[model samples]
Target: MPSKSSARHAALTVAVVCSAASTLVLTAPAHADSVRIHDIQGTTRTSPYAGQQVSGVPGIVTGVRTYGSSKGFWFQDPNPDKNPATSEGVFVFTSSAPKVAVGDSVTVTGTVSEYVPGGTSSGNQSVTEITKPTVTTVSTGNEVPAPTVIDSRSVPSRYTPAGDSAANGSVNALTLRPARYALDYYESLEGMNVQVKNVRVTTATDPYAELWATVKPSENRSERGGSLYGSYDSQNTGRIQIQSLGATADFPVANVGDTLSGATTGPLDYNQFGGYTLVASELGTLKSGGLKRETTKKQARDELAVATYNVENLDPSDTTFAAHASAIVNNLRSPDVVSLEEIQDNNGAKDDGTVAADVTVNKLIDAIVAAGGPRYQWRSIDPVNDQDGGEPGGNIRQVFLFNPERVSFTDRAGGDATTAVGVTTVRGKARLTASPGRIDPANAAWANSRKPLAGEFVFHGRTVFVIANHLNSKGGDQGLTAQYQPPTRSSETQRHAQATLVNTFVKSILTAQKNADVIALGDMNDFEFSGTAKVLEDGGALWSAIKSLPKNERYTYDYQGNQQVLDQILISPEIRRDRAFSYDSVHINSEFHDQISDHDPQVLRFRP
Candidate 1:
């Protein structure tokens, strides 16, 4: 027993209310008051951060710091009621952790008091005994919305009182803003369909994720593609739960055979692929407010060029894109617009179970330049941070290719950012789980999964914008066959989410730039008649090019005993005005799957 003063110091208590999720999570105690500590006399757990939440569950440390000959360092638990962070938490590593090896999903949680002199950082303000989060282990409840739908105009809205950092940052390090939570960035809204107005958010720090958006009336009444996907985002950075922006499509609603007008930002006409030959033009902000549609010309004589390829894990081991220099360039053969799938970001090693693929996007640039396709500059990708997808995801793969020579990126993040916030509809709810994902004291989820990358692309002289993507493979099984079918089981919602992400981007873009030539292309991971492709066509998202190709020449991938279509190039009526564009799946990689990648490449050609 201690005196009054000492009693007050040891008064912290912790409790964990069990939930449907397998594990009961722990919240840190109030600041200043550290967890109590005491070295266990005899136990095999000789580590320093042991016996605390850092051990995999939330608990009070026995003491601040304990040292033993072989046991090394030791930390006492402050709260006995709290368990460790998780079973395989990413924290509590045995050696000095390097900054580069911080493992994207690897985050330590605890009090960020003054450093312990010999600690990692100077005035670090993070928890000492951090246990990195895991994707599988850190589960949530009812994340899937109970299917539902609504008109684009009936959605609701909430004002998030602005803060000092609310304003967009400078052009150099544009502070990419995350989707507003008050707007419902990640709450379940399956039954409530909504339409989100497209908003443009430019920042220097966040170039790939400059735009953030929300889908109002997020629910739907039926499974129709348009209705199947109310509104969704790929970045999963945050959710914007709000009522539909009372907006509707009025202009001769852009559809097949329709042309789109061009967008003029300043002195430049913006893009060439747009104009009368273009399809549904996206023009507005997906961030907030209602997006009003504007009907425009339906016919243009300009031809547009588009291409989609299954770069087959384009990420090379050494992070060099030059590996395929011969195929990408010298190959004009090199497309005017290219959409690549399987681009990766570096986080950590890929051996064992850590998904943090060492390959990153910079390699893509190098490869393109090495292949001599440097004429096409840089563009945008989906996920803002590659560490851990905003949602409960371990792998962090994204897409963002650009052509500085044509369209210019206004709001953009410089390199990589760990902040949870993003611009407009460009980045919605984060893919990471609601909670930090560490399951134990050692198992930190590494970032290493691939997701589609969609962004505004300007067609030089044509004024058209393209939305690129890479959908979830029907799970990428080697046993896939022409007659094979797997209903959203192994990777059901995974692919669906990819489609939904694509739909949201298209709708938002059209809302903002009505009649702008819009192109949606990529390796959809599904065939022509697959549910994934149907959803895209049904939503009037794109006029798929393969629909015109003969059945024998339609496939871009064939392996095991099956031939399926994985790459596609679709265009909005705005970008497909008349016969201005022609597209076909290329067999360069597919023919030599073993030598190159496993998927095929699709190319589109149009006269700007």
Candidate 2:
């Protein structure tokens, strides 16, 4: 047996293999450059097959765990193992499936990966092999300890902005077919817990430069007047996310077929169109058992609880993601979870004579951190290719910004760190990503039905998520009102449809899962009390959060001189208790907009 190293490295992160760490041996007939990790916490490893199909070329699933589905796991191995470990760091396969019994070690063929961030801890890398290895039974492997995978499935589907996938079948490609919404039942589950597996998602393939993520939830009925549900719960219909696969980690797919093992910490939630889904939060797994505080118990401040704000269309140059992030980071009235719209999309642009998205977005993360934003990092959509045969401005739009120490998450496929909201798409899979003359025609079957841009995140230890967004603008001011007067323009029709879809989605979540803490916010492209506003309010959801506040404190964005109330922060029943309030509408990049874009911004204050 090769002595396994247990030296704990702390640079990067990677996925785990089984319960505890283990010692692994690679049998290669040729001299191959390999890495070995030693003293990995306490895990051990060993090679089951010496040299057959795996040929020591670094491939195969060495272990398996049952979380909920038969998914794969990889131990982030940086260097090859040559010695013994002080502790153990076995790759863990969570609880759910057939189950990995004590002394159960299987030798298979696949690619072993350097521990990845989505893995155990830092200084690690993860491997998602192209080919899966065959599970060859071996001597009963050492029984390694298991870590907890606290579930977050019931956090409500309302927070998943316009691109998360589900099994509800509400949408057919980019378009949605109509039926009895069952909208009333979808409300109560807003903050509950559920699981979504194997979700294949899509997003707006718009080849634009604006840092935007426009989402639409449902369709058909609410097409008349816009609604907040569509905007807030846009991605709940199980569609495409520029960056994510669907519903966090494709749980529905995992749930339906075979799976490892997984559970829920919050209430379980499901949709008519989708199966089960939940918000992402700190895992209860790998319990350090050291003075840890549960986020679910985060207290609400007495003066002003932290509120959520969605700054509409806040695109600045790539150089300002971090430093400029602080400009909006510290809200005047203050908020715990500040939901921003139109962050900064980095797809493809000639920055210093080099095509770069990470170059700019990375700077944003650095700047925000330097500004003392605290452990705040970012995730993005790594667009397949945004080169010409492209749109004018490097086709990129995303939503990202978080207090690192305050939240934890896993990244899916996307562009840059900030613009990960919009991934490389084959077509306009969203609210029109690849429009005409841009990157060729795209998949816009659900063009007008874009869901809100969102992710499963945690706030103050509480398992909460945000659906940040901005919808189609009121294209032009005129020609809207042949049937309806003000707020109606030809260009605004699609924009209004965006509103209707959002409204229905939000209402559905609130109806399905009551007693949920949800916030449906962003630029509705219209004013309050108008079509979009009325529908959201009539849905009984507004009664919980924002409506719970005094009227004067509701508006987030202001107009020229009059208070048109274009931006807002709507909430659900569970979150209404936070006593949320409006901070102030803003113009973070006044100089830029003065130089480029249009829309202003909105800011809100929170107290949790």
Candidate 3:
């Protein structure tokens, strides 16, 4: 009964949920005449009895969701069937406030539905539901079903089944194998009351009032109390999202490594963000990890600081310029040079073939100066119309903002939007033939993507080569919540190719000058541990500065419940061997809900 907009919004939510799956146990009543919740849920993501009327569906109302488009109450069978594949509980979508109380044993009649919360085009899984119920309160004050305990042993360590060809890889197929796969496990317990004990927070609490946690220790556990979000092959099945069904205020603000001990009891619910979430009515106490917002690093006159930040599609029309500028100046300590990604066209997303970003760059520069930061001189090669893949017509590309007082750009002739930059030996030194030139623009790896912009600058009388990159994103790749366990990371293939191209260029620079100071940094759109990073670091030509930090402090981005590294700075051997480098993943944006960009900028201070 949700309105069109709310249904669309909910559909989007479910679409996000389809990215991953969780584990749970379900039970059915013994009565043959009365339809069980499992019968409606079936084995696939879609319900078997969808669009059909059913009578005498008996359950105890465990929780009620009165807010949002999904205003309904959840009920589950007290006498659960022995089948592990079947879910004992189901959501009764009333479309409005339902006259149901917790602990009330009710026999209801309604139509079964497979509702896609985000709408049809969202590519999300359908949540089986019962709608338009005519309820009969069999009794009040009935005991609720005991919550299922989910831990490392109870939930499957593996994330997904090997094959999803059956039932299109949906939980609705009724082929629940909770012991084998995590998705199957969560699907089996969908809507059932569940409990997670002694879990550590894997993702920080978001404004959406949800947090992801790893139940017990995981195989890819990080030193700082959270599990590493490994490659797509490893789904991190131990992790599950936690949602407070009662009050948003009750949900604790927690960071990665924080602990939620005692009994966090709630009903298993499926939504768009995290596939399976524990909608807990009773949340345990949160043990803080002393994870505080980091302060700006001290900058020295001899140290040349370089930083990479994804502005998240900054345009002239957007109003986040001030916040972003403040972060750059205050949080990043006003780095001498900053490689900025996602600088949109002048008119932003209007897409009217206007590819110039002078207006956008000027606005940001003006803001940075106003925010107690040094005035920056910007350089960029505008993309050929809408060739760059991003917001339609936005023409997002990478740009360099260097403080004129701290560093000077080594501008050479012949650099244009389409021409590829080459490493040339000038006066027996490795230097870019065309400063601020694209790296292999004609290469297939850069097709429809923002090509790397190579700029030469002089810092402390040394020629330093900087490559600003905004590589192909993980757009077509499956989300972690994908129905297919071990979701496909189709985006990595392109990123690997892109990394190879950059590495080749770095090798060319090293060939010209063995001790060339080369720094490649930006949003690579791949994790540090990914094969793409491995390819970039091949032959020791360049090293990811993030890896130099402690294992726990390597992330600059947070997705789902996993603190990850998407933004990075890679330094050449000459710079690395100098051993006079300091790096910090500026924790200004990614962990906070009120963030200016989804990515937290990373800074590297070194004396060349």
Can you write out model 3's per-residue Cα lDDT over 38-75, one digit (the tens) per residue?
77766656666766778989999989888776788889
Candidate 1, position 48, lDDT: 34
Name the runs in model 2 displaced over 4 angstroms: 1-323, 330-336, 347-357, 380-391, 394-396, 410-451, 479-488, 542-561, 577-608
lDDT of candidate model 3 versus the reference:
0.81
Judged by whole-model lDDT over C-alpha atoms, candidate 1 comes out at 0.34
Q: Candidates sorted by lDDT, descending order? A: 3, 1, 2
TM-score for each model: 0.40, 0.38, 0.84
Model 2 per-residue lDDT tens digits across residues 1-608: 00001111111111223212321223452222322212222121122222213312321222333332324332222233442221112232232342334334443344332222222322111211212344444445443223212122322233311211462211111211112121211221221222333221111111111111112222211111111222211323322111121233332211001122222222222211122223222111111111111111222453222233332223334333543446534422223344444432343332222333455555655655576654445443333333211222333333445555444543333313223132122232112121111111132312422235545445444434345445545433421101111222444555555555555555544444444344556655565655656655555665323344334333333221112345666665555555544444443322121111233344344533
How does model 3 score by TM-score?
0.84
| lDDT per residue as tens, model 1, 301-323 | 34334566545444345433564
Best by TM-score: 3
What is the TM-score (0 to 1) of candidate 1? 0.40
List candidate 1 segments past 4 Å from native: 1-304, 316-320, 347-364, 367-371, 380-396, 406-451, 476-490
